[model samples]
Target: MSTVSVREFSYNPSAVLARVEKGEAIQVTRHGNVIAILSPAGSPMERYAHLVAQGKIKLKPVTAAERHSMPHYEVPEDVDPVALLLAEREEDDR
Candidate 1:
């Protein structure tokens, strides 16, 4: 890691950028105060690497065939919430 003043960076941006291209992190400064850091970009998969490693994220979505093969819970027959609510509302009007 290295620091570069804004003026110094402005004067020789290519040199600073070249260091970053080689995977070194550089902190940019203005008035001796740090403003930004420039570093090499990571691969797309790197974004989710941490979550996948923690087992909190799945790399691939569930396959349609697997979804169809899974047994599903069946709701009780004739148990319509909307119908029950409507019946209750009708009773309230009486």
Candidate 2:
């Protein structure tokens, strides 16, 4: 770990970034109080794969209750539910 003032970081951003890219931890401070940290970005796909591998993620099971719980979009009172569903299905089929 290395401690550098914000001014040093700002003036030599490339040098500081090089340290960060090498996994060296940094502390950004203002008035001698630490404010922030710089670390590596997380890979979303890798996280999802790990969760799936560990069986921590589950697909939601579809049920009649699930279907009934869904909110209906407001349309003209004359609109029919069956017709709307058929139109949606037709669009999906295309």
Q: Which numbered prediction scores highest in TM-score against the true structure? A: 1
Please report, as a residue range, the 10-residue window in candidate 1 with the lowest summed lDDT: 43-52
lDDT of every predicted structure (CA atoms): 0.70, 0.62
Q: Write the per-residue lDDT of candidate 1 for residues 1-94, one digit (tens) a residue.
A: 4778999999999999999888776667787665666657883444554554454664454589998997564436669755766877899999
Error of 2 at 67 (Å): 49
> Candidate 1: where is the Cα deviation over 4 Å?
43-94
Q: Which regions of candidate 2 deviate over 4 angstroms?
A: 43-94
Which predicted model would earn the best lDDT? 1
TM-score of each: 0.44, 0.41
What's model 1's lDDT at 25? 64
